[model samples]
Target: MKWKKGLTGMLLAAFLCGAPGVGIATPAHASAGEYKFDFGGGTVETGYTGVSASLSYDSARGYGFRTPENMRNVSASVRFLATGTKSENTFDVDLPPGLYEVSVTLGDTSRSSIAAEGVYQVINMTGNGAKDRFQIPVTDGQLNLLVTEGKEGAVFTLSALEIRQLSSNPVTNRTIYIGGDSTVCNYYPLDSSVQAGWGQLLPEFVNTNTFQIRNMASGGQIARGFHQDGQLEAIVQYIKPGDYFILQLGINDTNPKHNESEAEFKDWMRDMIRQVKAKGATVILSTPQGRATDFNANNVHNAENRWYRSAILALAQEEQTPLVDLNVLSSAYFTSIGKNATLALYMNGDTLHPNYGGARELARLVAQDLKRQGLSGF
Candidate 1:
């Protein structure tokens, strides 16, 4: 079956916390996601099954895949597999997509001298080691644990393999939903890179297969206009329990056509935040970034933008939700960089829209804020 677009690769990933299982849920030890085997036989948790390309499964002989070849990492008692080298053959565990942590115990419980090569897995592991835990991003696919000693043939012991669905709630991984104006729109192969929005660069920072960035932001959308156009409703449709909503609507709302009084803007944002939280999602509020100095100096749009920032700050304070404060960050960035350097990020000398350079910088700042906010799945 087709899973959600962002739910790709391995179902889950793990962050390296000293104690392990920091952000994700921890099941009751080995039982939640563990597998054991034997040469004379083996056993598995209720949800696990071993797969191999070499042999047919038989119930009497344990009805499953065997660890191939002279890579002796298996035993009949509390059997575990140590592996090295990327080989054509491997034993696989079939798993449905979600967040998961794989814990491999390296050696006998009494000994610790298990090491070689192959654990550095990018495409695959071509080494061996005793124990390591990884947050795997799995799709609707098989998790292949390779047990080999490569051509060099090193010896390693494997005992007690444990796998756990990190998130007991099963909704730990999430998507980042962005809602805003052109500033946050995913600018494509446009007239130029300068005609870019920060959203376009956002995906570059995230592992799309794990943390998907849905840039639902458009070229021109205010809170009221977005609602009237059904954009907000459409956004709400796919938002599940584990998701994020970054709302930045002030740029257009601060304009004449979509102008909202400070009080009105605050009211609208408050309602929007309330709606999002009601759906079991986290909502982050961002203020509109600054336009070029010349533009801010001459255009009525600047005053409107300022009003929006005020309202946004008030709303953030009132709700106690996280705030990106893009206005402050962008303003500081421009000030630090100075005019000529900053202008390079502006489009066609227009102070209003940022070019690709600016967008990327904006995205970097946004990503940093997300990390600090702990919205990032660690």
Candidate 2:
């Protein structure tokens, strides 16, 4: 079989910890400004393979994964002995700032093939002060290696593979502001359990070195109320050129307390778009997530729910703003998983507020949408 080299600068160490009979030394350390973390050493039984490894930073907020900027540098190396059979393997790394390189050598005259190796550079050009963000994307910088058996009983081994970080200046930085209901607000100790919002998970997907996410969503506030109460104005004032605004509403909007009509709702959405665009910032309209109730085939509740959603869609198209169809996507996902399976994500049986898991799922979907639209980079 053919043996090739594959490596990434952002390789994770978490999975490597559990690789079969693998031993890892305390990660080698670099000076404070430039940190180095490493993972290596394991045995593979013939056809049996080793686990993929990675290293991540603890954001101290319960989010275990590290953002690109938070990741100073990463490297992965492994040595495995094959007993009888051959295996194909791939390694993954989380992308971070700096220049990266990889080298692979075959064991026992096996003549391993070097499938791939390279360097990736992430530069932040925005003037935002957040350094824990990375502008370089890791998606394109992946190395694939192929290993094959020289002879029927040939044992293939891999030696120390390394990655390094290069120094560069902090470039550009942008900000993302979130506005919505309590479901998207940050919670302190006072209202902990009841207030988990998807906005909290938004940071994970964001490359903090290039962009910062500021959540301004509050509880029990509708679209109209948010503007009337000056929350909208506050958000607008903080928005700088090249910033982005994510607006998610409709939960509290439908509440009798807000009592806004279809026309009023459309107008409000249009005005919000205009104001955001006026600031030279981009606006992304998110449809509210679906409620837990599963209307029957003939139920008209689904049709009634469409009113607000339709208005949002209409306004988005009219204003030429980007749209994230959270309503449709979440509903389809929940339906496919069934109520019982999906309930675990909701907060305290409340269809309105999402639990941490739900919030994370929502954030992932939103990020996916952003990437698809090429808006996440903003």
Candidate 3:
């Protein structure tokens, strides 16, 4: 079957005028817009019998000819014109609040995946898609088109794919900025060391197309030093209304040799919270991970370790900021797994830095906390 324009024609026309060979065939008076994206030369594994592909749409970018969705009006479909064999592929499309449809055609077979698509009757900022100025549900967030094949070797090829925006609503855009120590800095020279920080892994959990994640963390820097060195200034300047700031410290702050006292540390954290809030951005506090130590068994070693973990917790409660208690969470997991089992999570013999697994786990924990508080919507 030859591909025909469906809903997203106007948007596709605007996109095509900027690019050569692409064209929109729909009339100008049509209420909705239709878009077509060709994933030529894109190969799928046919050996995997259950593999699938999807269509995705990002207001910041464009549309994903491949993605899957269960919503009635929001979905995508693919037509396999040249098939080498018989195999099934899973298909999905993620769209914003707009209406969408998906139709899959395999040789002589065809199916209309979506029945109806449209816009929301009422809109508000806190609600989904309300923050978008256009009022069209097209997501400024990520629209993932995922294809999964059950078999490892199954492969397939596509002739064409379509994405339609059936609604007039626009999507919202938000940014999240990260600030912390070396544990969270953008580690480069990828192979230099195994030291990993949760900040590096935090972006994977977020929808970057809609929400921007900026990593401003530096290695081996304390809270006061970050502000003095202009890192904080850079972060503050970019922060706008409806943005978020994640402040993670304590790794370098705990160093007594640096002459950073607990009282001074607490003051620094408070100052950061005050300043970030002044910019109208939300603040999230994260505690430092625990060192591998047994307080119950070793009195001398535990007694001499003077970092005030409790003070940070107190500030979180006093300031009413969203807190992810990594120290407490990691300690609980460490205790449950026993000293030897937990060592694999940390990097090298040092108890402070974490390995890849540890960093991933920490990121997961923070994501869980964000979900529990329902703070991600902002």
Q: What's the distance in Å from true for residue 299, model 3?
A: 15
On residues 182-221, what C-alpha lDDT tens digit does candidate 1 reach at each position?
7877543322344677876887676666775656676767
Q: What residue runs in model 2 are displaced by over 4 Å at the alpha carbon?
A: 1-172, 189-194, 295-307
lDDT of 3 by residue, 1-378 (tens): 222222232233343311222122111111234434432222321211112233333333333332234211111213332221111222223344553333211111111111111211111111111111111233433223222121223322222334456444442246677778766654421223366677767767776665755566666778787666555665565566778888877778777777888888889888888888898888888776666654356221131233466776788899888887776666666666776766777777777677777777777777777878897642
User: Which residue runs does candidate 3 get wrong by more than 4 Å?
Assistant: 1-173, 189-193, 294-306
TM-score of each: 0.51, 0.52, 0.51
Q: What are the per-residue Cα lDDT tens digits for candidate 2 across 310-373? A: 8888878888988988887777677677767677788775866788778878888888888889
Task: Tell me how candidate 3 scores on lDDT.
Answer: 0.49
TM-score-wise, the better of 2 and 3 is 2
In terms of lDDT, model 2 sits at 0.52
lDDT of 3 at 192: 30
Which residue ranges in model 1 land beyond 4 Å of their true spot? 1-173, 190-194, 294-307
